[model samples]
Target: MTERRMVAAIDTSLVATAAAAFSVLCASTSFAGVLADSRWVFPALLVVVVVAALGVLGRRLHWPLYATASTQVAGVLVVLSSQFAEHAVLGLLPGPAAISELGELLSGAADVVRTGVPPVPAEPALQALVCLGLGLVAIVVDLVVVGLRSPAVSGLLLLCVFAIPASLSDTMLPWWTFVAGGVGFAVLLASGGQHRRWRRHEDREQVTRALFGPTSTAVAGTAGVIALLTGVVFTGVGTEGRLPGSVPEQFGGTDGIGLQPFTSLRGQLNRDKEVELFRVRGLKEPTYLRALTLRKFDPERGWELEGLTQGVEANAQLPLPEGTDIGEGDAQRVEIQPIGYRDPWLPVFGVPRFLSGMGVNWRYDPASGIVFTQTNQESRPYVQQLVVPKPTPEQLRDARGPMRVAPEYLDTTGIPPQVTDLAQRLTADAGTEFDKAVALNRYFTDPSNGFRYDLQTAPAGGGDALSEFLFRGKRGFCEQYASSMAALLRAVGIPSRVAIGFTAGYRQGDERVITTEDAHAWVEAYFPGWGWQTFDPTPLSDGRSALPQYLNSELHPAQQPSSAPDPAQPSTPPTDGSTPGGGPQDDQGARPAPVDPRETEQSNPWPIAIGVLVLALALLAAPAVVREVRRRQRVRAISGGAAGSAGLAWQEVLDEFRDRGAQPAATDTARQVATKLLEHHALDESGAKAMRALVVAVEREWYSANGRSDESLPETLRTVLDSLRRASPLDLRSRAFPRSVLQLLRPQP
Candidate 1:
């Protein structure tokens, strides 16, 4: 092959390599449904880019294939070491210490994989695994595209990333992610060049190239169609509304709802818009709705439900919670209508005694306080005759524990030392378990304790995230408060479990509308005589958050009422007494004064506003900027008077045609492309003359034995471009977002 032809081949391979890398990156976006945030995306993206860059550099240096692949691995190791490993040889190399730390992170990630639910926390270990996995995928894609020159085979490797979350999680992958992967695959196929073939006739002195060559058009088109069909499938197909690891159909709601109950709870609260999940009628008083009770707690994994248990049918009469007497609590009637919540687990106000209007698929596990079904509960509406226990402070203080509850509730095997120390210190003066529970709840709600309600907490660092929330970082949402408080209660020998559900939402009209924003987590401690008592340690700023009457010291001992509403009185709307800032308020609607002047001062908004505006404008102009830069680079190349100047000039014309949304077939020859451009744009005599001359120059550069430079080729290309621009003036949208630059984002014609 000639020198110019060799350079063109290298350029085509490099473009294909870049497209392969992009395909993997696009496929990685599907993990958003699996992980909590997009934190893993950045590390995955960084490692892929590093791998592609090293592959390109190795190709340019003409290294052996093994040497190039090895270099790519080394580059990934260096990146992983910098991101996750603590110590390195020179801060850039992966040493023994770095490798050891990497092994530890991988081990932790394995544990996460086994126990974590969808939308699991994006910890350091998970992020490190993402980087390493994507880096390996990038290396494979690079090798297949650049070394073997087969872009189609590399797509199969990219499919592994897309298929992982789809097969693992019960939730469907987002539709746009599939579209992105399709577009990337299409670009890969388009960049793979057509092969050339020559035939010589005995009668003729000069050899003639074939009129048409095989191209990747059919393969790319098939891939594009498949991607579109997959996107439609993702949108049109409906899931059965079952979460991963749900209980078997025989036993109602078993251990299927495993560890990481807090993951879904936190995800629901972090949504940008609040969606109403349920509407409850005849709720006599405000109370927290219970969906599922988590009895098992692991310091590394947080709260979880217990193992499988035999359950009874939920449509008939139900037994009271374990260790509870028949007539110890007040009986109340309420009706709950499911709205947007589609999970299998059903929501109830309190311990259910008699349930009506439930199907056979629904089962009740009385021991764990959970009612679940084999199918979705979106259209299911049920009535409950449940009982709410009311206990006074004096009774709780005097009642002694019989210790009849499950051992799982009191198991403190994984409780951290910090939690034990804090619990002991806070409850040392208290004489009874009830007093110690009150002290712990008071410590969480106290403003002096530096605990505040913030959805966006400090970024998770190494070590235990719960410990960090308890001692170093005190600001967090409901899950943090509830989990930390439950851990502390367990550390102090009080049998406690975390309850996952919603708060008493504000009344809309006759019914209480509970939205995703009302989703809350609280500590439910099991007292031997009283059974279970509800306590919310989260310092919610809203007035809807009310403590039980027993926890309220302001109420008289004899006048204390049940937390559940009375069956005799009419239901009324709760009062709205939220403060300006998210500060806790008393029952009388009074907020505590700010302790620091800085807390009272408001932050300026101008800087962030200006920065956002600037970023928006830049993004809007990105296509035009990139197109202009590419044109300048090609024009400079033509001006250099090199051997491939004619090829560069022809590429400029092709880009102009692409900008006008004209896609010529890959089989079109140089002269054929010039003819198409001339006829489509209806150029004048001067432009036509320039176009014909440039085509001849390109043909000569490709076919001639002694290839000569065309000094006037740059000027000729510019003349043709000016004529085309004048004949078909681009609209503002077309110019700013040029098709030439954005064609890779959509399917080709």
Candidate 2:
């Protein structure tokens, strides 16, 4: 009867300790991140599995504490593996083009994880590797406790059991993760006494030993290689978005409703490579592309707009520094273009002067050559001025020493050999890296290759996608062309990344309407001090890459004077060549039908107000939650059940023993009040055993502290009183407890 009671007490204490730990964990986890790119129902169902596992262990199936914990832990690992398969794991590529290709392929698999449906990314190679390596490692560690019977090993396993919650999801609420996490925590609580002793075990070792064999290793290696190589292909896809100066030419939008439900811009972004939405002509030196500054990175799969903390320096608003060498340049006009893309972000060259005729939120970053808009840049064109320097080719090349990479950029973008090989092949005869880089770009971008500007492509070949492009499918897009070039280059060892943008200005009249159709992707190579230089290797685009070309009614009259000139004439206005929208030709002067500021001001304020109000209401409801929580706790205590002061002490001891999160050390057990007399807090073997004795008493007799209720509390108190008779009280006892509970004090060692 005593042994049965002791076992029940241990189990109860574990449950109690887990509950407390679980509360802390839930408070810290973020469920939204997991549900963002994925469907909440998958993980919700997974959590349900854990709850069900717990329920079964308690009721019908009655699994041991270890069995319940192991099952839940396994489920969490599966969820995490599915999560990694979705987004982040592929983001480790070195370049944009590589990343895009891999991302698309994996995104297909992510579809399954999202819906909790079967048939995950079934590239047979990846599936065999899914559960063999790191997955096996986790199971082995868990088995070290279960099969090998080592408590120390078990504690380590339990500590690591939360890996999924920590690393996989963005901000998984520690609470939900604790559902599985509590099992390991429960196991840790029971890893003392003879129960914790190491013993020889077999079943788990059989699996571990099998996994270490050759077949599993090869499977793991293939998966890694594939992910790494494919990541290299799609690296540039993540950067696909609207640039400055692009106008709405069939661009996507909410059409005045809510977020994308069907045919939305949210997921359909990065469909094709054409980043350039604006253009800054006559800029001094080539600058970096600056998009929206990410305020906070949601670990799940998106970027949230944090407050605009980064802006012009406060000091800059004051008198300029003496040695700063800050100089104002001539005012240059920019012709903004709108692309058919869906994001609100607009790309631009040089610094943005201001959003002149815009009805959208926009920001400028001079450090990188970019302009960002709040809505799809393809729908509207905003005119602006820029301050820049126009440098000659020689000046740009010789102005500085050899190439240099920014210190901050080194860790993220290390050069690979494959890129270098392609660079060498492209620029074999060039004098310098810059000359070679530019020459290679020029060669590939030459007119003969038929690199026409077309969004559509003719499908070709078998399962081999890249093969179709390089050989059979000659006609291709920027993404195809860039990835092909980037892969061959990475094979050689060039520090290169895929670049996406516009070719040049598409002139309207005085200004340009850079269309979404003009979006393009190229290759960028780091040239030491020169930094990342853009290289467009697409053929037909190179023909019109420089300056604005006016599609005049009268083509160069010298080349062809009459409107009735031959079809093969170099430049002539044909009767069939009338401009599409009969609107008057436009240039950089005053724009027609300007943005009506009155309409912008007249926009209904209620929608934005309602959004703010909803957010406010959620925040206001917090206090009521706290009050309700306290009331329940109070009622439980007054019920004369297991949660009174005595029960509370018992609970505290169980928690104190677990020592999770941040806490002081566990110095004494209930029986050894005198021996420790502040002898260091560390417990020796004898002290440990003595503490274990007290644990048995509080656990079975006062099991409520361990998250279970006990009806025998009054009888347990009498039994505790009898035990106290045999113990001697110590000076420390007088100070730690209340004077009213003198009889409740335990005898010291």
* Best by the TM-score measure: 1
Q: Report how far off residue 719 is in candidate 2 (Å).
A: 93
Name the 10 consecutive residues with the lowest summed lDDT in model 1: 200-209
Tens-digit lDDT string for candidate 2 (618-725): 446534443333334333442466433333334333322222111222444433432342133444444444445444545444434364444543444333323332
Model 2 vs truth, CA RMSD: 23.7
Clashing pairs in 1: 285-565
Model 2 TM-score is 0.31
- What is the per-residue lDDT of model 1 for residues 1-749, given as tens digits with 9 covering 90 to 100? 33222111124445556777888888788777667666576567768878988997798688999999999999999988866776977765899989988998898776555434455556678889888988999999889877887767887888777765665455566766776777677666555433121111010111111111133445445665687577555433334322234333444233434445565675565443456788998887777899888877777767777754657788888887776653466678999888777666788877788888755577787667888776543447889998777777888788785767778788988877877999999999999899999999989877677776666565556768778898887867777888889989999999988888887777766788887767788889887766778887876545456567787662224444543444354444433322212444545755542222212211545533654575578679878986886686578768888557787677677778888888876656666767887898899888999999998888788888887998888899999888888888788888899887887422111
Instruction: Give model 2's clash tally.
Output: 86
TM-score per candidate, chains pooled: 0.67, 0.31
Distance from true position, residue 661, model 2, in Å? 88
Against the hidden true structure, what lDDT does model 2 obtain? 0.35
